[model samples]
Target: MNRHRFSTEEISIFRRSLLAWYDIHKRKLPWRDWHDIDTNIVAYRVLVSELMLQQTQVATVIRYYETWMKQWPNIKSLAEASEDDILKCWAGIIIDSIFYWSYFFHLGLGYYNRARNLYKCAQLIINEYNGEFPNELETMINRLPGVGRYTAGAVSSIAFNQANPILDGNVIRVLSRMRCIGSDLKKKSTTDFLWSLATDVVCPERPGDFNQSLMELGATVCTPQKPKCNECPVQNQCLAYQQQKEIESILDIEQCSANCSFCLKSSDVDTNRSLVEHYPRKKSKTKQREETSFILIIYRLTPKLEFLMIKQKQSNLLSGLWSFLEISSSKNHLDQMNEQKRKTYIIEEIQQMPTIDTIPSINNIKLAGQCRHLFSHIDKQYIIYYTHCEQNDVLIPSTSMQWFNEEQVQTSAISTAMKKVFNVALPQIKLKTSNGKKNGTIDNYFKKKNSKV
Candidate 1:
């Protein structure tokens, strides 16, 4: 019945001794270079790594990071690349995409495009701060786009050799095991306690090395699983070790997951239990839904054979994106002529707009290929329909409507669903205007109506 706890004085000694151990045994990583901090390369690396590490492992990021760096070394290069190309770089990491991580790619792109903002922060360092990375954590944290307090401390101490304490999951684990902290690390009180302990233990002069050393020790020696107590530099001073005869024997007293407070399987009674194998069961799948969509591709040749693109603003899901007019239905009964009860449905759906009653001025209509896009919350099955319109009289221009050439459309931040739409519609457009093929159907109708008037 031995409890592991350390006094404030002993914690300071642990910090200094662990830092000395880190001086001898720290592993070299790509982002640790002294000269790279001032450049965007390190910033980009840190951003991408942080993004990639969300719900993913460090071992998985190595090859992907290397390949991405080799292909697009800088932010400008990444911005110039296609979404498909970026997705290729993110080939293996798709399974790791939870809600927050799904937005990582977007955040990365946002920051990359806004590199001038980053330079605003970086240039000030070279010019005003004299090429030295900022030592004060809060100042550096305020400049970056997405960096929070913990991340700021990590970068400041590790990159700038500042006297800042890092309180990541690894450090929390070390402190929790040493003190036998029963509270969950996610709780605010637990976090505050751990941060205070981390501050108490950090060696001031080489705080960066000291912090990294603690993390490195937790990652390698004081691991969540069978910790190599013999290899630990400060094993003699550790309260957990001094109370119990040996690390292995102490760990054996409880389940493997119970000893490590950060273990995913940790519970209130016994925190450490090897539940890694059982984690997949938490995410069980149910029956998938079937959905259908009708996408309209209307074309007018006034501005170099451009198609009508609508900016969907009604819903936040597809808001402000240039897409075709779309309708989602439960069944594929679009071709069935609606002579009865169709008007009521149309009136209800298009409550504000009454212009949809007169066949919608659709010219020659062609059925394009179907596409399927799967989302976490919803499933979509798209059937594309293209209509050719060489006549200018019927074309309407509003804030939502845009006519862009193929080159212009290609460079935009279009969704993957729209990309699939373009793949099928482009060839259909070429077919309509292959040999002076005009939109005669709609033109003839307009001419006849004008004669009647």
Candidate 2:
């Protein structure tokens, strides 16, 4: 799987130009060097940020990263933290950022496995590595849970200045266009070839700066839609840009090799998009599966205003996060069931809750609200149903299933779906105190709802 060898002269020029651009243009990310002299701390920081930034956008990841570092700060702190703590920290905690509390955009950050994996990695670092992060890739870094080649490469090169290669989405776009690769990117052959190219061109001496530069170049300049070719520092090195300039003649294109099978042919050019955009052939997206579920907010009004919340046992979807009792069903099944049947189903589901010592008779079940939430591969419809216990009944609490008052619900680390449900459901709770009077002003409830972290 050898790529066309890049000469030392060409590699040197690429490295120099790319690094210069990065120094001037790289985004001021929080996980970047914090003037920390210890390379271990720097490596730990990079690993955490990479894990968080995997499925979420940078804007969303920034606040979470800041909150995480502030709480854990180091490898030992993260390892010492409980699984619940890790999950809660991984979920959005905005007590610190009161400035954004009024209008914080709540992104699900759903892949709960990433958070669990982060916790596992931290424990491994402590128990196995004596609280020190393993610097070498093969030594222990890549072996860490949820760490792949790309993440390992990033940590190694960026933190230890190791001569490793990284190929993220941005870098893939940049390299595919640079080499004018037009094959199906979803295919293994194209991916392997791109990895080979990435390995070949990585700067040996300043690998850290070089990798960051390439990523920055792709992120800011060589963007997917309309690449700023005129402003690209390495436009001279990009074959697709040269192709777009009508320098397709083999002699004129400096980067083009002699009839290479790896490069896109002239016939591959898409008229709809320019030549550079054509290189990285866009992969067709798979349609998201439709999911329909009933999120039952089983509550009580006797002792105080409290709602029952069940901790999710499923790891694949919102794993270990707290939400109301959920009953999943097919859309057709849900449609066929009438309102009375749905309540019967809810009653039956409540009876089966593992921790319930006594299944309280539901007083009045009503449709509070409904909302749609999108996961990575599922479009979920939440039919929010809320009900309370009879006048003399109360819900017994357990480790997995606990009760939360309004203030606690506002502060707890519930799933984003549950939070969305609360936005609609809680206001209609008829917030009555034990003495059967309106607890607080409705305006305060609205204010508290708006400030949910």
Candidate 3:
């Protein structure tokens, strides 16, 4: 049995109130500013923005979105871009999201999924759909690489003006409050209930605006922290607000048919509880598993200054970008390795490298220091080290290992964590000053020496 039902009149009021609020208060975003509403053009822009936004904040994606639009401009252009180029742009140093990190000395983050999916989506649209976004949500959901139900509904309603339903975090929050649902959001049952409500209230005449309004209301007014109920245009329709006021028994609301299976019990709503902030309940935070990464910034001084880089196996690529050779283990394991053990481990790892034709005697390598990079789930420590070839050893490059001079490393599409490693290392790899003093930087050495590959 349906727990809640909105009448024709009630749905009408929701549309009018929500659209009026959205028209006046929607954030000034680039995707919303298109002057000409060509269906293909709108779909392309919407697809890129929506893909970039997955698991990311709007404030963080704006610049990347702008740059991406200018660079590609259309589906055909994006379809032609290489995987490396797509990954480079999509990750854009992976600035938008922090969700790709993990622990337990296992599995590369699925950070590459978004980049790979979006790339495949554009190509499919170009090759299969004749360079235009499909007009129907079913086609998109079924055929497009990364277009899931939420993305499909968004593209359908916004680009094609279809009355397809959508659900994202903001929508989930807003609807949960409006309906006063107090169930665990992580559960699938709660999500199905919300999706039903979304399908019900979305006005066919203005589905895009209506859906955007729900998200806008959730983001700006019905926020997770401290919702501004006093300013909410739909506060009259919101069950949570009414419950807070004790204005009327919730069961008596004119539109609802059955008692919600998920509503908070009356006794659970303490009189001491504050305003409308108690609508949608939040689950407790998961305890994050912690780990540390031991990184090596292996370098060579032959011919000129250069850093050795591993062609990183797919399992180890961070954010799906190549990294220098490194190891991951628990902090306890790292702590147990004494100075001599650490030195021995570094030497053996180098000796195993196929790139070095003749590594010098064991004394050339030295510990450079430490740096840290924070990910959403993992707390990582980069234990840095450096070594130099004997200035005359012939270095052989492999498909799995190669040496890059400072400039090449700087210009390469390195991951954000890798960039931090370079920053920690540059100052530590001391350079010789003109007076034969060892007080300069490798950053300067590259500029003067014109280092070879």
Cα TM-score per model: 0.44, 0.56, 0.57
lDDT of 3 by residue, 1-453 (tens): 333456677778988999998999899998888877788988888887887777567886888889888988888888898888777876653644454343122124656687788788888988888887888888898988878999999888988899988999889888877777876787888889889889999989998888888888988998987788889999888877776678455333233334556765543443444535655665764334467766776666654677877666566536445577676657777789998788787777666765444545545556777888777555678887776655456556666667788888888867777888888877766443221234266565675567543
Tell me how many clashing residue pairs each candidate has: 7, 0, 1
Candidate 1: lDDT of 390?
Answer: 52
lDDT-wise, the better of 1 and 2 is 2
Candidate rank order under lDDT: 2, 3, 1
**Regions more than 4 Å wrong, model 3:** 1-3, 96-107, 247-260, 266-275, 285-453
Global lDDT scores for all candidate models: 0.60, 0.77, 0.74
- 216 Cα displacement, candidate 1 (Å): 1.2
Error of 3 at 97 (Å): 5.3
Ranked candidates (TM-score, high to low): 3, 2, 1
- Better model by TM-score: candidate 1 vs candidate 2: 2
RMSD to truth, every model: 20.4, 21.7, 21.1
**lDDT per residue as tens, model 1, 118-214:** 3344445555665554556787678655566776777666656567787776776666666545454546766786787787777777876787788
